[model samples]
Target: MVRLSRFVRQTFLSFVAVSCVVASAPSHADGTAGWESVKEAGVLRCGAAVAPPYVMRDPKTGEYSGFFSELCRNFGQNVLKVKVEFVDTTWDNIVAGLQSNKWDLSMALNDTPEREKAISFSAPATDYNVSFVYNRNNPKIAKGAHSIAEIDKPGVTVAVMSGSAQDKAITAVFKQAQIMRLPGNDETRLALMSKRADLLADANTTNMLLTEAHPDWAVAIQPNPPLAQQEVAFGIRKDTPAADIAVLNKYVSEQVSSGAVNRLIKTSVQSMLASNK
Candidate 1:
């Protein structure tokens, strides 16, 4: 009986030791599996949609530039210690691609409640607002039009990048005006410039560039209450661990605090201007 009791005690001790070892082992199940996979791959994939000053891609070289791309490169290199790959995408498919795991991150996504339902976001890198740009000489748009209502009239055609936040915003507000959903920024701008569209609905920053490019005719509506004001941040998979998001937030906060983001934006704007010239 003493020998049997000794064997039973030894078995229980061994079982407990094994359990402790399993419990203490690092878990990939804690929602950090995404980060683990990224680390294992040794490359962080960032989805890039061409939104000037936020993201830009060179047609000749296929190289990505602009603030968001630079930020993604920095995060992958400095924080994740991985090679960064820019996955070309369009605004229409940016969110869908992220959902499908085509990339680890989506750069310069506006954090809307609708998007929140689909994916999570890091802390905002910058504030964003939609604005309408039009040729001041166009008869469809009134001079000094201060509100969307002033422009939302019959025969007025508003052009926007398909599946963009601005497209959604203008679609919601413009009841009588025709909405032209083009596939790319260049197309939308061309629609406006060619007078096929009376107004171009896009980010205020983007409109600023357009207006600057054609100051003689381009005019951006400065609405008193702004339009679709929101936070622009990096998009991540919904299943990404909150801890991983916290790390990204910390990095974004540090960049914003140090004015690094502002500098990047300035550089991007300058580069865009130089390219246009």
Candidate 2:
């Protein structure tokens, strides 16, 4: 009986040891699932859309180089210490990709209500106001037009990219203006350039960048001020494991406090504008 008891006790101990190992293995696996993918891939796959001064592809170089892209690169290399791989995406699809876990983060975006439901945002990287840009040659739209209501008339055609803040705001304020929906910033700019549209509603920073390139083609209008200023942020998956979010938050906070964020915005915004020329 004593020998039998001894054998049963040893068997139970062995089973307990195996169980502990199995449980601990999953904790390690869980940790690996969060930030590990970024580290293993050696790159943070960032979803991005063209936003001109803020973010855009270099026409000549065919490369993603803008203020927003630079911000992501800084975060990845300097803060998170990871490589950054930019994935060009439409505004419509960027948020969706985050939900599907297709991308690690969005390079730059406005933290709107709908997006906030599915993704998280870091601290504001930049601030911008709404503005209108018109073909310089046409010169129909003028300064002192503060809102869409002021500029949008029966004959005027306003072009805006779908899924952008300008699109939403124009829809709300310029109900009378013939609203033309385009897929991306490039298309919207083309619409204005080709005289297919009278005015292009875009962020002030974006308009400034465009004006820099096509000095003779397009210009920024003002009502002696801008429509409104909104913050730009990096969008990450809402379901992102807490560990990953914590690291990103820490990095962003540090960058913001140190003013590295300001330098990136100033340098990259100008560089993007210069590249257009």
Candidate 3:
């Protein structure tokens, strides 16, 4: 009976020790939150793309220099008082990187049902619209082609980037129109310049900036009205701490109200185009 009681006591002690270890395990939200991670690392890892005007990746330097990239840099360095590290990620992988905590934020993420489940977002830095563009001389379609229903007639050939929200939107709207899924925006633009496609629908902000720079190759607009005006915001992991998120949100809102964000966006867009030339 004495030996049995001693074994029972030892078993109880072992269980308690194991419980303490389990309770103290490092969690996904470890020592610091997302915001703190940026500060600790001395650089915010921002994911961006060469999606011209918004987040253009410089071909020559292999670095990011565009509206969204500048915006992230300015916000991190000035407002958040942290260093900014730009990570050039393709549009397809940006969301996954955010989920994996590989990238801290994205510059021009359009809020969608699929994305909402994956990441936390700041208040919209600006509104987003998908517009159709065509070559200036050919200008196959007018500016107001909002939906596939409006633009996708039998003969219309649409250029799309496969697996993009624009591509999904087009598929949802136009079943009859033939879609040419190009690899990227540059390819799509080439397709349009080469007269392979009558229309190219992409984020309106980007298309507008490109049109401003290269008036001959592309022009775009909302057909009747914008199909939807989505708020573009930075995407972080959805599990980010509330305190960190609050700080980021406050800074973004302040910048937006002060018009600093707008100015930054405009300047960056101009800078990107000028540098590209």
* Deviation in Å, model 3, residue 43 alpha carbon: 2.2
TM-scores of the candidates in the order shown:
0.88, 0.79, 0.80
Off by over 4 Å in 3: 1-33, 136-147, 275-277
How many angstroms is residue 97 displaced in model 3 relative to the true structure, after the best TM-score fit? 1.1
Cα lDDT of model 2 by residue, 1-277, tens digit:
1133423343344334323312111221232334556666677777888887677786677688776787777767876478888887887787887767667778677766666677777656666667888875665565545555567778889889998878876787776779999999889988988899999888887787787777876777753445545567788766555445555655665666689877876787777766556
Q: Order the candidates by lDDT, highest first.
A: 1, 2, 3
Candidate 2 C-alpha error for residue 188, in Å: 1.6
Specify the highest-TM-score model's number. 1
Of models 1 and 2, which has the larger TM-score? Answer: 1
Of the two candidates 2 and 3, the one with more favorable lDDT, higher being better, is 2
Worst 10 residues of 2 by lDDT: 20-29
Looking at model 2, the pairs that clash are: 144-222
Tens digit of per-residue lDDT, candidate 1, span 55-126 = 999999999999999999999999879899999989999999888888889999988878889998777788
Clashes, model 3: 3
* All candidates: CA RMSD (Å): 12.8, 13.7, 13.3
Best by lDDT: 1
Error of 3 at 233 (Å): 0.2
